[model samples]
Target: MTAIQPALDGTIPTTSSYAEWVDDVRPAFVTAARSGRRFTTYEIAKEHELPEPPNPRADWGNFAQSLVRDGLIEHVDFERSSRPTGERSAVSVWRGTPAARAGRVA
Candidate 1:
């Protein structure tokens, strides 16, 4: 993961109601990073087949933000990818924290 720790101190409020997303998503990201494989928000969102009607990124963005805030993952690169809306855009690739790069995490 990149050394882009941007003061996650106040990024997520305790009462933000996004706790569930973090709970469900953090493990998967840790698993992927532990396996030495990198991914992007786009890939994960698409994999879950989430819809945008309720929210553009639905819970995916919330989950990713929570991980980033908790020091579990960070941006590694950018790649052109397809969005859930069928639009192509440059997306940021992310990986687990250094500790999770060993490919052995819960």
Candidate 2:
């Protein structure tokens, strides 16, 4: 009956709740489109202190993907920045779409 469960990273993946992530992320998305304050997915994830696997990603790409799918955000740029491994990496920057600025503060 002894079985190896997977090796557990057991780290929780996000710093905020789904709704909280939306709230935190929306403003950045709006700022990007309005002021050209470009940002990367990595930055966003890091800003929210997203942890590694097993626990569950707080929001992890889903929120952004949802926004993109709903026409709420769009990729506006890419940047090479430091990652956890101290390696510079290219990350996609996003901005709010016209649909998002429909007078709604999403």
For all predictions, the C-alpha RMSD in Å is: 11.1, 9.6
| Runs of candidate 1 exceeding 4 Å displacement | 1-17, 48-54, 103-106
Against the reference, the lDDT scores of all candidates come to 0.57, 0.56
**Candidate 2 lDDT score relative to the true structure:** 0.56
Clash totals, every prediction: 1, 1
Q: Best lDDT goes to which candidate? A: 1
What TM-score quantifies how close candidate 1 is to the native fold?
0.58
Task: State in Å the error of residue 61, model 1.
Answer: 3.1
Model 2 poorest 10 in a row by lDDT? 1-10
* Tens-digit lDDT track of model 2 for 39-88: 66666545544433223343446766876776767887777765666767
List TM-score per model, in order. 0.58, 0.50
Over 4 Å off in model 2, which ranges? 1-36, 44-59, 102-105
Judge candidate 1 at residue 105 and give its lDDT.
35
Looking at model 1, the pairs that clash are: 34-103
Question: What's the C-alpha lDDT at position 95 in model 2?
Answer: 68
User: Which of the numbered candidates is closest to the native, going by highest TM-score?
Assistant: 1
**Native-structure RMSD, model 2:** 9.6
